[model samples]
Structure formats: structure tokens, C-alpha cells
Target: MFVIGLTGGIGSGKSTAGEIFAELGVDVIDTDQIARLLTQSGGAAIPAICGLFGDAYITESGALDRQKMRQLIFSDSAHRQKLERLLHPLILDEVSSHVQRSLSQYVIVVVPLLLETGDYDHLIQRVLVIDCDEQLQVTRTMARSRLSAADVKAIMATQVDRQFRLTKADDIVRNNRDFGHLRAQIVRLHHFYLTLAE
Candidate 1:
């Protein structure tokens, strides 16, 4: 089956764009959600994460404490890589299993860090980037996440910038406008991917 790597910076409307594709009958496996599953209570990555980050990152219920871990890794590169190292393999393995079972013409893997991860390069046939301006990104992210401007800016610091993501894109969806416009773009791109798959 054909696999499309769908990615964007945080709060770039990548998830919304993936929804549009799903509405058009495209299969979408959101890596963010799957990665969460991998780190959840009693998940395969739980023991590893506990070992690496200690008990603080895990909740009493055994699920990962996302906010605590986010704060920890974002500031420390070594801790960040440790977190990625513990989770990436499990995430990729789950993605592979999902892709194997998917019965669609194409599967869009929604990976927010597709470029940063490096583990999924071999799985991607095409890269579709949902893009907008950096200012818009900060605005949207703060609105949706209820994060402070400083918090959003901190997250943006770690990502590949807008121009860089555009440079790597096989297709681009500009999401600075309205959702209707985003939907129309997905419809057009869905047709294109379908044709390619055929």
C-alpha cells in the first residue's frame, strides 16, 4: 500500500487536515495518538520511560504524565533524546503493525515530527506538509492549547521552521485561511494520491 507522511509544526492544523482526508475515505494513523498509547499505563514503553526519567513522569494510575515529561525533555537535549530513544522504537513498531493491517489505497501517517524522528524515512512514499506562517502558528497553538506565548515559542524553537518544512514537502497545504479552504485542498490532494496509488 502507498504511504504518505503527513507532517507539520505543532498547531499547524496538521490534525485538522488529517481529519479532512479521513472524511474523504483516506486511512489516517496519527502517530501522536499511537505514541501516546505506547506510553500509557502498562504500555510497552512505560517500564523504559520509568527507568530513564524515573517515577515522576508516570502517574499513580500508571499512565505517562505528559506535561511533566514535556517540561523535562524540552529543556534538556540529553533527556529529550533519552525520551525519544525510549519511545521511537515502540512508536515505529506500532506504526508498522498498523500499516500492515490497513486496507486503504493509501495510509496517511500523521507524524508531527516526521523529519525530526528519522525512524520513519523508509516508511514514507510522499511527504505532505500542512503549513502556515510562524506567527499564525504561535497564535493558533496558544489558542488551542491555552498555552502562554512563551510556552508556544519554546515549542516552536525545537521544530524545523516553516520554510524548512516547505522545502522538504512533496505537497503543501496552506492552512492559514479557513477550514473550508483546508478541506478543499485535502480533496484535491486525495484525488492526486488516489491516482498515484492506482
Candidate 2:
């Protein structure tokens, strides 16, 4: 099975492209989703996070306080690295198990920090990058998450820049236009990825 790394800068519409690929029946594993799952009640990473960040990081329902945790990690590089240390290994292992169980002809694993993480590289056969304008990213993220301009820009800074991501891509889907144009890019990329698999 082929593993493709689907990545993009924050608010670059990675989810939109990922969904389109999913509709085309390519197995898609979203790392952000797995990260969220890890913090949910009864998840593998919850205990370690609680132990490190303390019990206060968890809610009465036994869920990680994601907003609080986000602030903690983003503010402190040491804290962020510590969290990644505890979580990345378990995440990769579980993802591998998931892919093994599914036995896909090809799989798309979407990672927002695919470059920054350095946890995966040679593991993926291809790198698919979703491209767009920086100002557009600010606009879309602000519209969706209602984050302050400073906060959005900070998040963008944490990941690899757009040009660097494009430089590393085996494929690129440009998303600097309307929904219809975005959809067309996805349609074409879907066929392209499938053909490579064959």
C-alpha cells in the first residue's frame, strides 16, 4: 500500500481537499483527527497528558482541555516538544494499525505539520500539498475560527511556509479561487493519485 502525505499550511483548505480525496475512495487518515482522539476520554494519550500537564488539563468528563492545552504548548516550545514526544509515537503506531486493518490500495495521511514534525518522511511515498495565498489563509481562518489576527498569524508561523511546502510536493492542488475551482483541482488530483497507485 502506498502512503501519501497530504499537507498544507494552516487554513489552506487541507480538509476540503482531503474530503474530496475521501469521496474518491482513497483511504484518508487525518493526523489532527487522531490527535483529537488521543485526548478524548479513554484515549491512549489522555493519561500521559494528564500526568505531564497535570489533572487540571482534563475536564470532569475526562476529556483534555484542548483550548487550554493549545495555549500551554504553543507558548512553550519545551512543553510542545514534550507533548509531541508523548503523543507522536502512539499516534504513528495506531495509524499504522489502522492502515493495516483497512488494507487500502493507497492512503492519504493528512498532517498539518508534516514538515515540522519530522516524524514522517521516507514513510510516505508521495507528498501532496494544498496551496493558497497567505492573506486568503488569514481571511478563511478568521472567518471560521474567529481567532484574533495575531493568533491566526502565530498559528501560521508555527508550521512550514507555503513556498517551502510547495517545494517539497510531489503534487500540488492550488486553492486560491472559488469553491468550484477548488473542486475541479481536487477532481483532477484524485485521478492523478489513483493513476500513480496503479
Q: Tell me each candidate's TM-score.
A: 0.97, 0.95
Off by over 4 Å in 2: none
- Lowest summed lDDT across 10 adjacent residues in model 1 is found at 81-90
Tens-digit lDDT string for candidate 2 (103-168): 557888998888888788757888888889999899999999988888889888778777888899
Best by TM-score: 1
